[model samples]
Target: MRQGTLCLLFSLLLLTPRVQAEEAAPSGKTAPFSLSAGSQISELQQQLKESERQRDELSKQLQTASNEHETALLGRLRQENQRLKLQLKEARATATPRLLTDQQQWFVIGGGVTLLAALCGILASGGHRKRRQWLN
Candidate 1:
């Protein structure tokens, strides 16, 4: 038991030096801090703050520009909508029977396509059930 305890202690001491050497080897060199280092840090902090203020001002300007652009776009859209409304009113006042007939024809075609799709779906579902029963 005594020999075992000594061996354990000896192994631990040898391992500690290896671990410490590994840690030191990666660092390569060590630097010591002085009062000027603190001053340099303070200077850097001030410069960072000034840069942040400039960035914030630039951001505000960008936002103002975007807002102006959006307002102009909305104004243009309003004008276009008013113009279209006037044109639509004029067209409605002068619409002919031929135009009305064409509109009705398009509506009937759309309805016919919908009815055909519904019939196809019903037939496909019926076929699927018979196939499933046969497989089972």
Candidate 2:
């Protein structure tokens, strides 16, 4: 029974994944499985390096494209701002000058000036009376 179980296990192992080892040292002897495994590891490392290089290049290209897109947007915004400014300037230039046909503004200014003059005259006359009282 033990021999039968051993045979079954060996067959199972044979059915599993395996690498064919190369011959070593010019003799008919097969190389160790470790040699095959080590070669596979090296190949995997090389592939990983290649994939990383490709990823870096793609990232660089994406960054450059995005930068160009941003620059174009900025340029458009600047042009729009300049156009709006020019429109504003033209509107102001072509604007009609306000004529104060109503006398209300002039009346307000004249009244303020007249009140100021009256206050100054009153203060000047009051100062002279105060000097006379002090002398008395």
Candidate 3:
């Protein structure tokens, strides 16, 4: 009978739940309180979505600025190319006759030197033949 009473008391103690209500309770006396995982996850997901949208907007702005800069640079280069081509054409038209005159002068000088060398060779040979005749 005593053993049966001890066993009944032990089972009652083991089956009883621990008193955690004090730990879970909020300090503020007036307001009811709760902890929820779902609400925190919802808030975090909203913040992530907002950050992703901001990043997308910044990327679009950067791309647009880069395209505008490239277009402006191309326009400047084309204008410079056209200006250089016009200058080159004008220089060629003005300088052609001067270049031809310089070439003609060099040709005339070369021809005069060649003629003088031939004349000198003929006179030397004639003098050599006359000397041979006098000796014979």
Candidate 4:
């Protein structure tokens, strides 16, 4: 609002002098115009100070908001980091364990293989065989 008003004041200040010089306005009108000019100058200075003050306030708020945003992001990242760590721990816990010693593990594996071989042999031997009549 102040900016527009200042622009209009500047335009009028420039144009008014030209108009008065051409028309030769009376001295009474000149005094009022000069008084209004001085008032407008003071008003413009006040508005400038107000604008500077507002700009400073806005800058402070922006700084505060940025700090808060950074803090929030940091907190979320920490939470995610903790969650991932927990997931890793749980996954490791679910992984296969070497509960049995190396020697016991080998023994179990050998026994299983032997048992399977024996089963196969037994099944093969159970099949009927053709006998020669003369040999019988």
Q: Model 1 reaches what TM-score against the true structure? A: 0.50
* TM-score versus the correct structure, for each prediction: 0.50, 0.45, 0.47, 0.45
Model 3 scores a C-alpha lDDT of: 0.84
Candidate 1 structure quality by residue, lDDT tens digits, 12-105: 9989978877744347665666889989999999999999999999999999999999999999999999999999999988986464477899
Cα deviation of 132, candidate 3, in Å: 16
Worst 10 residues of 2 by lDDT: 17-26
Task: Give the winner by TM-score: 1 or 3.
Answer: 1
The per-residue C-alpha lDDT of model 1 at residue 80 equals 100
Instruction: Report the error of model 4 at residue 73, Å.
Output: 1.9
Best-to-worst order by lDDT is 4, 1, 2, 3
Clashing pairs in 1: none
Predicted structure 4: clash tally = 0
Error in Å for residue 45 of model 3: 1.3
**Model 3's TM-score against the true structure:** 0.47
Off by over 4 Å in 1: 1-32, 98-100, 103-136
Looking at model 1, report the run of 10 residues with the lowest lDDT sum. Answer: 23-32
